[model samples]
Target: MKRVFIIAVAIVTLLVSAEAQKQKVGIVLSGGGALGFGHIGVLQALEDNGIYPTIVAGTSMGALVGAMYANGLRPQDIFDLVKAEEFDKISKIITPSGLRRGSMGISDHKNILDMLDKYIPANDFDSLKMPLYVCVSNISKSQGEIIHSGGRLHEYLLASSSIPLVFEAVELDSMYYVDGGVFNNLPAQAIRDKCTYLIGSNVNPEKYRSPIKSGKDVAMRSVSILIYENTKPGIEMCDFMVDVPVNYFYSPMDFKHFYEIYQIGYKAGLDYIKEHPEIVRKCKGKRPDW
Candidate 1:
């Protein structure tokens, strides 16, 4: 555990170093727009489907956030104000221009992943296991633009939990976010990239690993659950891969914590990718030949 933590930190530190070496992009704001980058996985997905960002996208922001938190910011410092519904306080701490500018709305996190291709391939794009009612109730009662600000708020919560958030995990939240409706459906554009899906009722026979074609390492049933140990080739039969522990998803954290774990894993994956772009390409491709 200690070694894993150390390695994760080291990777993040290296990514930050690389990011700092590059010149910062110009902030094209509407007089006071605090800029943020899109998630890398989302970017890869977009590229896979022939979609790319117009102005640097969110990948840069996700990378920068990873670098910043791993180096400059502390989980406690950002969260104290956020839990108090002080979005500005959290943003001010991270954003030099004193705002989130634009986030999780017009340029949401998941939309980015659904558009790109990850070279490494991942099973992180599965359904979410959050408590629907609590999330919606919180969204309705919350004091902000429920879509954008609320999304950012969830991000704050994720950061506070010491879990790194990423584009892929954020994508899962669009359908499974705390406030996301249970019976409600996603918008037309949102599910556009779901070109293919698989279903297998009995995967217990051990020879049924098929649906999931992307070969990946380290999969999770959710934020608190570990589906397979690092690099274990999960079962595959037809259109879906099998072998992740279902109990992992049942362990229970509010929708917020689930998102946090997703963030942590996604962030780790992205950091690994930024420092390892080749890996992202394969993962985002969905069904890689490798």
Candidate 2:
């Protein structure tokens, strides 16, 4: 009996060690306009604590920040850039004049394309240190058809972030691309089986009250860590937006509110990392081997 107990303990130890060693991580970002901006703080906290993901998949605004971060840009830098910019500039991008009669009208496609040209120009995503899976829903196709790749990256980001009625559907490769969030706000599908661990930062509030509804929904269900507001304890998830208001995009930006919201996400991420032994074992300076 003693010998059997000893062997069982050894097996458990070995299993834990193997699990610790296989820590390739993936991050999923959900869309929610200015509210989605909170993901920046969560991402910064992850990196600050050494929880780097091997792959990142994002929808809408989450894609904007996630792709930028994957390309080596810092969260604060992205924030600063947004802060310095004028609201009028955003208003210009969303101007109704940019849209014309079509299946999906009322778009800011042209202005947004111009902005993309001026800011994040054409780039080969494969050149980045980490792989970035961009999420986009096809507006011209049957319900639930998604385009995960195939075109200029700028086009992907712009299309994924373009909110219907707010930002117009983007025309690319002869197809109209709209926000990926329409079909799957939590675009964890992009990660699929590509990594050992997945961390999904969901900005949408409806998931708290609804069941997983789409392919993206099922993908989010598979993530190792899902961060959202008012979320009940699940397989493995965190709730940080509990106090933050759900309606953030249409509302005007107040620096105080933005800072508060940012800190809410940051602290939530920081605390989660600090509490997880599996994550803390491989701190920032000591990244797990790929």
lDDT of each: 0.24, 0.61
TM-score of 2: 0.68
Best by lDDT: 2
| TM-score for each predicted model, relative to the true structure | 0.18, 0.68
Best of the candidates, TM-score: 2
Clashing pairs in 2: 50-284, 107-168, 108-168
- The alpha-carbon deviation from the true structure for residue 187 of candidate 1, after best TM-score superposition, in angstroms, is 10
**Candidate 1 TM-score versus the reference:** 0.18
Candidate 1 local lDDT, 92-147, one digit each (tens): 22323212354332223322232121211221211111100011112323321112
Error of 2 at 142 (Å): 2.1
Which 10-residue span in candidate 1 carries the lowest summed lDDT? 25-34
The reply for model 1, stretches above 4 Å from the true place, is 1-238, 241-243, 248-250, 253-290
